[model samples]
Target: MQDTYLHHNHQEKHLKSSELLTDIVIGMSDGLTVPFALAAGLSGAVSNTSLIVVAGIAEIAAGSIAMGLGGYLAGKTEQDHYNSELKIEYDEIETKTEVEKEEVRIFFREWGFSKELQDKAVEEICKDKDRWVEFMMKHELGLDKPDPKRASKSAFNIGLSYVMGGLIPLSPYFFVANSEDALKVSVGVTLICLFVFGYFKSKMTGVNPVIGGLKVMMIGAAAAAAAFAIAKVIDGK
Candidate 1:
């Protein structure tokens, strides 16, 4: 119990920053993809500057609100799911102590403990309710406490990023009053942003930043390109 408490305290102090970065990448990627594609497609189809501006603005507003609400709801749902899982977890630990202890023994064995040591480790871990639940939550069920505020903020960031991403590609057309040039500018902006986002994501996930950025750029460019091409075909028909 004392050793486990010390380990937990140390782990808490060394809480990895990797999780936060991963969340940011997820938010950024989500923000960069859809709206840009949609805007590009619409711009190509309607070429009327006024219509493009109107549609683009509407998409940004709707997407932002939807994203924020969805984020809030999802965070709440996660908390609910964890609460439900905790009950099951408690029941399992309470009713099946010996079985759970052996289960944990096998788990520790896999992590490079000798058979005797693993049994001892499992005994130590399962002796306490908190340790037992923590182990099960981490290894067996893969659950964690949900932070509602963080989730909501993450969602808002995603939505804001998406709106910004969407507007980048469309703003040029409206201000420049030339659909083709605007498309070019919008696409250019989007690709750059995607590349930057990719690099950051890669860094967070421990991947190559350059490759990540390139991947993001390619996807954004491809989606926008495909949309424009599709719109062109539709208009021709």
Candidate 2:
């Protein structure tokens, strides 16, 4: 029993860590791509590194806030949906006990429980209303109770990740005097970062890391290239 409890706790912790990783990926991917493309575009149209730096900084600030708020809202929505389903589950168990019990029996039946075992299991589980409600919430609704602080944590994590990623492409502009030079360095740095980020992300999610890395690097490269081309054409006109 103690071993089982410890294993369950480990699984729960892993799930939470996975959620955090997902938020970082969402923020960082956009942070790297958008700023890199913006810098590349401006480099094609302008000669001043200072202008690109200022615009990049402003974009990073705005992007972080927007992404953070999106994470917060998504977390809140998940929590709200879980709570609403939980309430309904409790109500059903209270007002429709027999139906609820039958549902539990069906689950046991699906698990290949004997009729005698199903009866015993249902009785044991339903003895505690809270436990019964929790079981139903997990099996019937497939929702684990979300952490109360998930929204704020997600916001902080995503926002911080965004800032960190956005700075990578923008950092060259701080030291390079010319926008074109800055853009060249920025492209190299950002593409490498994107490949490395994608490699680890894919490994964590059980994918082919090399292919994933190349895919991510190509996406950032393509975005920057498109922006640069468009800016060049527009500036030439």
Candidate 3:
């Protein structure tokens, strides 16, 4: 029993890490792609490396804010939804005691509990209204209570990841004097980073790392290429 409890704790920690990884992936994928594309586009249109660098910085700042706010709002929505459901569960347990008890019995029935054991479980569980409602929420509604701090944590993680990812592509622009030359270096660096990032991200989630890596690399390349093409056409006009 002690070993089982420890294993369950480990599983919970792993689940939280998985959630964090997902948020990082969300932020980093867009972070690498958008700034890289913007820089490529700007490099195509302008001869000034300074202008491209400045614009890339501005876009990263704005994009991080937008993405962080989106993550915060999503987390807040989940919390609110859980709270609303919890309240409803409590009310039902209070006002419809017999119906709630029957629901508990039905749950035990579905679990394949023996008739005598089901009666014993229901009798034991229903003695405490709080415990009864808690069980119903978990077993019936399939909702876990979300961490109250999840919204702020998600916002911080996503925003920080975006800043880190965005800096990679933009860093090359700072080093080179010419925008076109900087773009060439940035493309080489960013595509490699994208492949590596995607490979590990997929590997963590049990995907084929090679395929995922290539897919992500191609996507970054395509986005940059399209943006560069559009800017070149506009510049030619």
Candidate 4:
């Protein structure tokens, strides 16, 4: 039992780490891409690095807030959906006790429990209303209780990640006086980061890291190139 508990705990911790990594990937991918594209577009049209820097910063701020809010909403939605299902489970257990009991027995039966053991397990489990409903929720409905702080935590993680990723391409503008020069440096830096970020993200999610990295780099490069080309065309007019 002690070893089982330890193993479960380890699994839970691993799941949380995976969730955090997913959030980072969500924020960082957009952060690096959007600002890099914006700077590239502006660099083609404008001569002043300061303007690009200001625009990039503004974009980062807005993107972070937007992404954070999106994460928060998604977390809240998960919590709300779980709570609603939990209430339904409780109601079913209360108003339809016999049916609920049979369902529990059926679940155990499917799990390879013998007839006598299923009866004994259902009786013991049904003795506690809370435990019974929780079991049903897990087994029948297949929903887990969402962490109460999931929303706030997701918001913070995504927002912070967006800021960090957005800064990479923008940093060059702050150092260089010319937009074109800053863009050249930004392209190199952001491309490298996109590749590295994608490699690790893929590895974490059990994908081909090298292929993932190259794909991400190509996508970012393509986006920036297209944005720059369009901006140059517009500026030429």
Highest-lDDT candidate: 2
Candidate 4 at residue 194, lDDT? 96
What TM-score would you give candidate 3 relative to the actual structure? 0.91
Tell me how many clashing residue pairs each candidate has.
1, 0, 0, 0
**Full-model lDDT for every candidate:** 0.75, 0.93, 0.91, 0.92
Q: How would you encode candidate 3's per-residue C-alpha lDDT over 1-237 as one tens digit per residue?
A: 999999778843242345688789999999999999999999889989999988999999999999999999999999999999999998998899899999999999999999999999999999988888889989999988898999988898898889889999999989899999999999999999999998988777667998999999999999999999999999993
Q: List pairs with backbone clashes in candidate 3.
A: none
Model 1 regions lying over 4 Å from their true place: 1-20, 112-120, 148-150
Q: Report the lDDT tens digits of candidate 4 across residue range 1-237.
A: 999999778843232345688789899999999999999999999989988988989999999999999999999999999999988888888799999999999999999999999999999999999999889888898887788999999999999999999999999999999989888999999999999998988777667999999999999999999999999999993
- The list of candidate 4 runs beyond 4 A from truth reads 1-17
Rank order by lDDT, top first?
2, 4, 3, 1
Shift of residue 14 alpha carbon in model 2, Å:
10
Candidate 1, poorest ten consecutive residues by summed lDDT: 11-20
lDDT of 1 by residue, 1-237 (tens): 999998778843332564345444554565567667777887777767777788777877887777767766776788789878888888988898778887888888889999889978887887889878878887988887666576677677666665665666666766867676677787878788888878876775568999989988998888878988899899983
Error of 3 at 104 (Å): 1.8
Clashing pairs in 2: none
The reply for model 2, stretches above 4 Å from the true place, is: 1-17
Q: Provide the global lDDT of candidate 4 against the true structure.
A: 0.92
